[model samples]
Each structure stands twice: as C-alpha cells, then as structure tokens.
Target: MHDQPWTTAPLVAFDLEGSGSQDHEHEAILEVGVVPLVDGHPDIRNAYDSTVNPGRRIQRRPWSSPGLTNDVLGLAPRLDAIEPELAGRLNGTSIVGHNVNVDWRLLSPRCPGIRPASLIDTLKLARLIHRKAQPRTLTALLAYYELDDEVTELSGGQPHRALWDAVGAGLLLGALIRELPHGGSLTVTGLHTVAGVSLGDAEQTLPLF
Candidate 1:
C-alpha cells in the first residue's frame, strides 16, 4: 500500500441515526452529525448535528441503542428543511464512518446532489487490521483500542447518538491510521481499494430522481 497521508485532503466524518435498517421500505433518517477533520483531527467547533423528522414513526430495534424515540424526534425538522446545510457539510470532502454504507443508503436519497469524492469505512478498516477480532462493531473497536474512556467523556456520554458516533468514528480512524504498519499512511485510492467500494460509484447507482 502506498504511504501517502490521507489527511492532506479535507475529510468529513459523519453518522446517521435512522428509524430503521430497511432503507428500501419505510426507514428514514432521524438525525445526522458531521465533523470535519483538519490534518487528521476533528474540528469540533465546526461540527454539525441535527434532528431530522423522518416523516414516519422512529422504529425501535432491539439492536439499536436507546436515546432516539418518537417523542425526541416529534418536533424535529424534516429532511428537506435541513438538506441545504447537510449538503454544504458533505460537499467536496472525503467521507468516513463506521459501516458507512448504511449511512449512504439512507442519506443519498435525501440529498441526491451531494456525492462524496471517496469514502473510508472504519468497519472494513478495523477488520483489515484485526482480522481475528470478533464483533467488530464501533464500540468493540473503541474498547479494543482502549479509546472508550475518551469517548465516554464526550459531551453527551451517549453511544448511539449521531454526533457522538461521528466523533468516535473519527477518533477510531486516527488510532487505526497510527497503527498502520511501518508508520504508513493511506491515500484516498488506497482506502477505496481496501474498502472494495466507492461512494462515487454508489451514488451513481442510486435511483434517478
């Protein structure tokens, strides 16, 4: 793998809280958080998070962490209302997240015009680094790296909230990058190759509006 630093480019790490997992059906995004990273560190002052009215009841899943509920999202603005700001955050930046495909599936339909230049899936990266580790969820990876303590000190101290997850993902990415063999850094193309997917290609395959 080429040892080019990926942080030289603008990176936006984001997360989406959705009503459910079945994006093809009634599932919709309930909240979104975006954190722009500068030279491999999150710029919290410019971070963005918003509760989105999913236009349907927010389904509670057994696997989902607690916090999001119909009551919490009842008064939130709809996706269309926040589309402008959300798009602005995503525009012209590489994307990063844990299991980011899920976020893209739910987000692309809502903001068709904003297509990321590339993507770095932390889920995939974690597996690549720690192939034998079981249950490679974000929480598990954070704990494995001994980064959970820092995450717990975050503003909300909650796990599944959009902003918290986004920040956690960014931190996890930094840790993973540092652990790269021989002090190596990943290029955008290198990340895409390892991820075996591209946000640009995924966006093109999206249903035409």
Candidate 2:
C-alpha cells in the first residue's frame, strides 16, 4: 500500500477540538471531525462531526476558543459511547492532519485499540516543501494556496471548530500534493518522505502562527 499512488490511498483528514489542557494526558477531546478522501478529494458531504462531552469540568477555555462550554458539552455523548463509531471509521485508514501527533495523542488514550494505517502530518510537509513560507498555520497555508474561501464555503462550521479545520486540512493536502514535482503521480511513500524521517524533527523546524 505504501507503493500505491497517494490519490489511491485511503487517506482521511482527521481533527479534533480539545477541552482546556495543554497536557494531552489531562485534556479531553470536545469534538472530532473526519473528512475522508474520496479518490484524493475531500468528501465533505459525508464528513463526520461530533461533539464529545468531557466527563469532568473544563479548567480553562480551549486554545481555539471553540466555545464548547460545560453546558454545551454536557448534552453531547461521551467518548466511549462513540468509540465503536470512531473505531469503525478511523481504524483502517491513514489519517492526515496539520499537526496530527497531537490529535493522535489526545485520541489514542481515549479510544484504545484504534490504530490508523498511517499518520501524515502536513506541518512536516510544509517544513520540507515550503521551508521559507512564514507562519504555516493551517489558515495561512489555506490562504496562500487560495483555498481558504472554498474551505469556508464548503465546511458547515466556522474556523477553530472541528469540521471546518478538517476540511481545511483535507483540501490543503490536495493543494500541497499538486505542488509536488511528481504531482498526483507520486506514491504514499513519497508523501511520507515529505513529512520527514524523524517523527518530531519537522515539528521543531516550523511553529504555527
């Protein structure tokens, strides 16, 4: 499968909004969104978005300021309740995210036995491909690639939210793929190379705005 072209790979754009803590171990995921790539295209119509009710009180506002408060989250389903659904969708697919490691960390513990086919971080790709690009925030990359407007129009939610960011990351993947020398002719391994060999190396090279 690694030798398969990226466009044919089962890549899903995954993202989540967390409740207050910077420490992944302590924080709780408040929302999750998955935009599955259909032939390398974001399938927004079939995208999954769900708000998760944190079991405990959120100590502070989430970094994204998603406005997911106790009152709001209390009405949502707990992580375990949706674990089956989550596992079914995420288990067998390779997930792509702007800073995927964080989401993986936040999610792995909550949903055990849920493993993805691969993890492709766009942040790492930007570090290697567009080294000079300043402030590689997902929004910045989207704007630079002229995809911000289209992402906003297609995503049902707003920025800082799960669904919107998932769409942004998904489309951003397509944009970056076109920037490659081989275009859509590249393999999944080629895409991984863009993410770099060292897991945490590319992350240290670029800081999101």
Candidate 3:
C-alpha cells in the first residue's frame, strides 16, 4: 500500500476566529487554536491555544454581528505572551485547516520566525474529493462525513473560545484526514495552485512526505 498518505505529513490542524468581522485583514485574530498531529494521531501533549489582544479595540460591527463584543475576549492572552509557544509548534510543519490561508493571515504577523513549507486545506480537499457538493464549510463537511453527531452538541452558543474549538477541530481533523486520498500529504505549492493562493515564496517546495 501507499502507507496511508495522511500519516506522511506532520500536520497541525488549526483555526482562528478574529475579534471583529470575517474580512480578516482588518479584523484581528482574538483567538487561535492548534491541534498538532504526528503519524496520524493527535499529539495532545503538543496542542495549544491562545488569545491575542489585537491592540486596537474589538468593535462589534452591528451590520455583521449583534452579540459579539470585546467582552468575549477579555480573558484571552495577548499576542506577545503567546509568540514563543506559537513559533515552537509552527516552525516547520504542514498546516491543515478548514481554510488554511485564513488561519495563516491571522497567525503569520504574530510569529515572524515561523514559515510552513506545506499546507493541506480541508476546504480544498473537500472540492478535490467531492465534485458536486454545494459548499465545503466546516459544518457542511461535518455533515457530509456523518460527523454531525460528533459536533452538533457544540453548535448552540459558543462564539469564539479558542481551546474549545481547538479540541473540536482536532476531532474533526481526525475524521477529515481519512477522506483524503493521501491522508494529508498535499504540498503547499500544489494547494496554492488548487486554491488560487499566492504563496509568495521563491523557494522550492519541500517534500511533505
């Protein structure tokens, strides 16, 4: 056999929820959640979550959201405090996420030291795996893979808790990776071409396997 491709890449399934809207650039990441994986299993010991104080006030734009506020982020840690740990975990790993690019923009500036060579996006993977799906959001995939029961209990009220969502993402990743042809061994350059991402690096793409 191919030795199961997902197990080939050292992946870190992650998610980032910004303080404001989903526009991302203007809306700073209030919380970041990471679930590191090695050899097809969740590396619970290495998992991490952090809350970033985006410096500017987290405005609750009524147009997009009504209940969201800065109060939800009051207890989260600032970016400076979380940088060391963030750099250590993300230094050289393949990132797998619902939409890896969105998480990248939220995470990159915080740690100038970390640059991942490979990225596997579950969103893009969904498209490659299923051609006729209506949409490929996290919820959609959860249902598509019959993982709805696994995550439905988590869907009522939690807006942006980092650790909570991180745990959930870890579970979802465990399920999602099974759907990929190569468990998770997709290249950053290849994903960029598939996702139309501008991976601005003049370096050769590394072998994720």
The lDDT leader among the candidates is 2
Clashes of each: 0, 0, 3
Question: Candidate 2: minimum summed lDDT over ten consecutive residues — where?
Answer: 200-209
TM-score ranking of the models: 2, 1, 3
TM-score of 1: 0.86
User: Candidate 2 or 3, higher TM-score?
Assistant: 2
| TM-scores, each model vs. reference | 0.86, 0.88, 0.70
Q: How well is each residue in 1-209 modelled by candidate 3, as lDDT tens digits?
A: 22334455557766676654344346566777676766655565666766666666675655322233566456657777787777677767776667666566556765667677666566675676678845566755666667555443432224245544444455566665466565456443443444333334313232121
Query: What C-alpha root-mean-square deviation, in Å, does candidate 2 show against the real structure?
Result: 3.8
Q: How close is candidate 2 to the true structure, as a TM-score?
A: 0.88
TM-score pick, better of 1 and 2: 2
Model 1: colliding residue pairs: none
* CA displacement after TM-score superposition, residue 151 of candidate 1 (Å): 2.2
Candidate 2 has an lDDT of 0.78
Model 1, 47-163: lDDT tens digits are 898888777775677855466778878888989899889878887777889988778866886788777776778888778777774658888888888877776675254688888
Identify the runs in model 3 with alpha carbons over 4 angstroms from their true place: 1-5, 21-24, 61-69, 151-209
Lowest lDDT block of 10, candidate 1: 200-209
| lDDT by candidate, in order shown | 0.75, 0.78, 0.58
Q: What's the C-alpha lDDT at position 154 in model 1?
A: 51
